[model samples]
Target: MRGFLHLGCVYAHGVKNVIHVMLENRAFDTVFGFLNHTTDIENLVGKDPICNYVNVNDPTSAKACTSPNLPSKSQYDPDHQYYATTNEIYGTNDPNVPLPPVAPMSGFVQQASIGALKGAPIQDLQQVMASFDPANIPIQATLAKEFTIFDKWFAAIPGPTQPNRVSAHCATSNGWYDNSKIIFGNNCRSIFEDLADAGLTWKAYYQENPPSIDCLSNLRFSSNIQSYSNFLSDAKSGNLPSYTFLEPKYGNLPQNKNTYTDGHSGSSSFANAEAFIKQIYETLRASPQWSSSLLLITYDEHGGFHDHVPPPKAPNPDGITVNDPNHPGVVYSFDRLGLRVPVTLISPWVPKGQVIHEPNGPQSDSQFSHASIPATLRSIFKLTSPALTKRESWSGNFESYLLDTPRTDCPTTLPSVVQF
Candidate 1:
């Protein structure tokens, strides 16, 4: 990555560099649904009392429902792992329970209580159903309002963070569905490798500790990974690579709300995440590359939160399924997509208030998944290498959404971030 390479990529749009900010667990409805309450955006509007999930312990009892601005403490992280997600989607994690014609999308409270089980204590089960008001995370809501936001963006897989993030980079997870700490050295081919192979410079700027990007062997030995601090200086100087993927801080968090940047429920605050995102947006806005740079902000998965949208069937990247002897359960086919998550496109090329529910391909029927991150990069940079997997080839990307002309009136500064 240390040479004067040929600029082989064509000018498809005004964008010369792309920055993708992939954050942690939170449902699209939990975060962006406030728009529906105030505007006509397809979200949890009018459903003031969002889904009243059944109390398994007592059928006559009413459990958690969606409330604005985090009505109470997010007791636990809300059990967004494999089996819990299954219960959250299908209303039962029991393998015997057949997939319904329509996903029940009705087990958040149950899953949060004891996961897939029939009888469980309903202690603080409201965390999974709690939605964020626009005032809670003003930065994200403002960006969605001022720029372009995709309503049908789903996570790449119907599982945890690691697998979906792997799909975000590798275009497939090599059949891993859960976030096992032992997933290192799996040798998953990533977009960073593809960029390096194509001689297009790229960097993965991370905060504090290493992110799930370290799950791939290629990035383990890569020098392209740098601290989040470099992101600020690099953006200030506008000396960014062709592609940049930013990862927020994860694990071992301090008590300070202003620095809780990861945005994961129960662990970090929305205001803290807003502070982090505000810096990135404002820095990029003032950078020399602002006019030619496009920023994409999204999450990894829904984290077992309540999203009413039933995920559509997804095209399998590879014909692979989970096979773990230690954890024997339903063998996941990786065919269905995870819950909806917010994906916003911030750039001078995007039309304000634009909402693309489906991919703007020739058919324009398929919705976007996390794999579209690499798929869009491959399409934009015009990489020579073949797609990492079939899913990348079929991934609904944002290549067609970019305008040929860049707008001169793009905002130079974002709205004020929420503070404690």
Candidate 2:
């Protein structure tokens, strides 16, 4: 029997625990290109010149060679700024060209070479074309092989962290496009509110102080926020709420204190990030709620990495626009999605080795983005409230991915991290 919608939405089979692990800044290709080669998922794998990272002006210029194994981090963050991404997407720094119907995904090399991105140098920039081998992060790869991977998932916008992160919970950034001056405006409501309104229990857990969801106007003072340590104890005690969102440690933290597990740009240690993923997975697998649990491991945005897939056209959320939020005199109507990110849905109810190549939704413009987070919650929980934004209204849901019956062969553990 299919999981039917209920008040405290359980995975049709039984009571469910939906744990969302929101990581930071990695493109689909940078993380999972190994699986999608002469295959489907859009990455530079098993190809002649996996990716041409030559100079923008001169194709034959010397640059960092594309490698399958990216070091723990990059030389610098790389330029994912709103205007810079426009260049990376279309592969041109030209200011006056019609927005190409299809993006070229060609200028990443040049953009990374610039010093605009944080901690990056103006010269000798590299690592943007790097892709992780399945062996590089064995646990992440094993989980994907063992569960479902959403190949077409994208960020909510083509800009940086703030706006996209806001969209992940709120379904819209309310016309904000850049990391310009605002960390997050107190303008939009988030899915957290929806969960609360419906009498459903949830919590946003963070390893660092001030959970990322706190930036949302509604969650600033929410009592539902808790420490990640609580997540560990709650999972073991089977006291977890209906919905859970996790924020890894961000910013600088001494190795002794706690390594940065957020994995932002090239600063974080891949070893720490992988271990964090492992810890969370093992905890969930052993939990009493394992059978009905669903863990979504995903990134906030591309964070200036290389993803061969071009972002698809999208409906403007709430039909709002930003007039030159970053670039003066230029306007960004929220009509286009951003670079692709990895969305791995892990659950006992999901068939092993499932890969969702396209959307299961009926909307013509249906492409799974951050908005899908709210949309899927609404469907699985049967929320009758108004859509958070026009975007989620048109977004797809993954309730169908949960199998009618829980699988008996689900692994209780994953391969150990093999970070190189």
Candidate 3:
């Protein structure tokens, strides 16, 4: 394992570190918390709650990618571009059928505006609460029937894979914006660097293996990272980093047993990701580290899931112009913005149903940027490297997810390692 340590005097003396596991391509669309269409749930209720969670392919019929605005040089019509560039992977619009108006923000918002309320009459909580009969419901039912917790969700961005992943990590795309160049530039520091400099040990674990392991011949930092299967070796040898990342092998098969080899996106799979995550949670929660450690479960990005909110403006270094905010001579900064993938922070400290409503955006103090995952690690460990933890404020404080009073004994029961 590659260790990151800051020997400078500014560091805090000692801290029991953290491990970050980034589960790539898992989305809230698959989670139980929220669903774009509630009607889809009427049939699944009273069944296994796990049935509520589904893979992207389950809703593939409704999977539609939209492009808000595309540059003219790209292969799309700005006025009638029904689908974005990435949507081309599946199919393009026929054009003979006139494109509908830009996708509406919300079905509720649209229905109420147009005076066409269907399904149930839901004006407020009282109406919704009275409508459901609890007598027939199971006591173990975990999801809320009706609740409103607000947070930032992405609206207009459209793409398939790598661009969305890069946007979530750095908050800006280096312009490769698509999977065609997933291996482009690597000169910049990631949220991981920020935490490492702060004296935290972080690790990226892949179910089958690590990412970018074979392509080290191009950019640097190749040897710095390791695979997920090797985590046990690192832990036994005391080389465990503060944060850990897990990448899936595109399909369900293990990396070595593949008879067919597609590119990175094709070769990587998720068939065993859910089981792997559960195992990791069980190991940590059963150990003495449950209270102090935090686990962030989020998708790399939305694989064209429909979210009703618009992408908010963010501070960008490579200024791109966006008309909504109306800032002159400034390029659109994606730092604090992008589409919403399901982000769930799992730890003993994270209260069940505790929704963080960061008013400004994810990068705001109220909201946490994905980068905040590393920021909290840096603050907790007190590594003093500026470059690595430069964007700490934009991220969240992982400490908030810990218990106010330290635990003398470990938790008696662990949360069922759940996947949707």
Candidate 4:
């Protein structure tokens, strides 16, 4: 129920606007994999010597797994369902299957091949091991070159979009893994509630209504939800809220056209997503609020792409475990984080061309996950009591990357999306 006019008055002291754009289903190595091929730009992919792994079950896995020759323009959506993501992560397609003592991280090609064989041609399996050219994702790549990129940022859960997204907003999915059941009745407290409790304002902008909306039981917050057009208008007028969550257009909707920007499979090209990002950046840069705003661009899930890095063990968000009757006997403790996803932090405050990774620690290596979203918000708002979850309570904050002074050399525009 908070209005834009009141946002300025309520948040005048040390209050900076945080804009989060959550894109769908892209892995770090899947979209930015080609950055490893670049010589001058120091990146996580190519720093280590390139090596190939052998998967006897997967004939297509003999060569170097990360290939730029993989089709970037194709509309092939890899299998990112709950079990499929498990296969892509643990390298085992079977659900609740025991993994070897030394996890191989070698089941991608086979999983893709198996996924393709179901309702898709067997020959299309090669698309799973393929990645896009860095040139094709110039906007994201350019941002990485200009701001801070998290090579170790991971999804909160190793499942599908709904659960991972729920973690980002609520710190826990409330014992649900897939997107089947509606969450409005779940009574979960979201960051939205946290912001409101602190007397700060927030907004959720979507091209169309996203699945996350159903998770919120309170209809009073519905007043803050607006169409995507309102986002552009607010950005230009400097009427942005203290926190903004933006959702790209999911391609499955009836109104979605060839210019889908969500970057999900079946989209015409990744160019659409780049163009969308470019516009958002330009709008923010041109506004008076640019200096005071921080923009975070990240993906919800890995979308079944091949990533070399294994996910690290993580603290359980809530004590309640997920015992889904559908996957009988499959108990989820929410202990392990998901695969790596591309995470770029853009602001005048961040250092140029900075790459952040896990810092040494006695516990687990320092890494960013979807839980970091709420954790950072809680830190910024200075909320003291009633933490969301232990995972978020221990998560690292991105504010460390913000500089005491702002950079004037941030690029205003990026290369146009190249058509295939």
Error of 4 at 235 (Å): 0.8
Q: Candidate 4: where are CA atoms >4 Å away?
A: 1-15, 36-64, 93-96, 117-123, 183-186, 219-221, 359-366
The model with the greater lDDT, 3 or 4, is 4
Taking all chains together, each candidate's TM-score versus the true structure is 0.90, 0.91, 0.56, 0.88
Clashes of each: 0, 2, 33, 0
Q: Candidate 2: which stretches are off by over 4 Å?
A: 1-15, 36-40, 63-65, 93-95, 116-124, 181-184, 252-258, 325-328
Q: Best candidate, TM-score-wise?
A: 2
lDDT of 2 by residue, 1-420 (tens): 122223344556443678899898899988888764226455556665545455666767655545676787553677787777887788674556678899978878777665344334433355777777778788787888888898899999998887898898889987677765455545588877788889988998899886667667756887889899999999998888889999998863555233688777655577677889999999998998888788999898887778878899999999788776334766678998999998899888887888876665537558889999998888777788988998997777778677888887878877777756
lDDT on C-alpha atoms for all candidate structures: 0.77, 0.78, 0.37, 0.73
| Cα error of candidate 4 at position 286, Å | 0.3
lDDT string, candidate 3, 1-420, tens digits = 212223232432233545544444322322322332233332223343221001122433222222221110111101101133222112222333332334222221122212221222223101100111222111111212221212343312244455444433444444433354545443445555565455555555555433532222222354546665576565445455666665545433554533211112122222234345455555665555555555555555443333333344344424543432233443323343434545545555445444544433223333344545544555566655542323334433434434454434333333342221
Q: Which stretch of 10 consecutive residues in model 4 shows the poorest summed lDDT?
A: 1-10
Q: Which stretches of model 3 miss by more than 4 angstroms? A: 1-15, 33-160, 167-171, 196-199, 209-224, 233-239, 252-271, 317-336, 359-366, 387-401, 406-420
What shift in Å separates residue 321 of candidate 1 from its native position after superposition? 1.4
lDDT of 1 by residue, 1-420 (tens): 111212243445878899999888888888887774236467877766766456544657767777775642343676788788888887787776688867878878877666532354543566577677777676887888778898899998877888888888898988788877534555778888888888889988988665667888767867888898998999999899999989887654464433547687764556667878888998999999999999999999998788888998877788888765555775778888899998889999887878877765422345688888887898788877888887777667677778888888776776786553
Model 2, residue 328: C-alpha shift (Å): 4.4
Kindly provide the TM-score of model 2 when superposed on the true structure, using C-alpha atoms. Answer: 0.91
User: Cα miss at 253, model 2 (Å)?
Assistant: 5.3
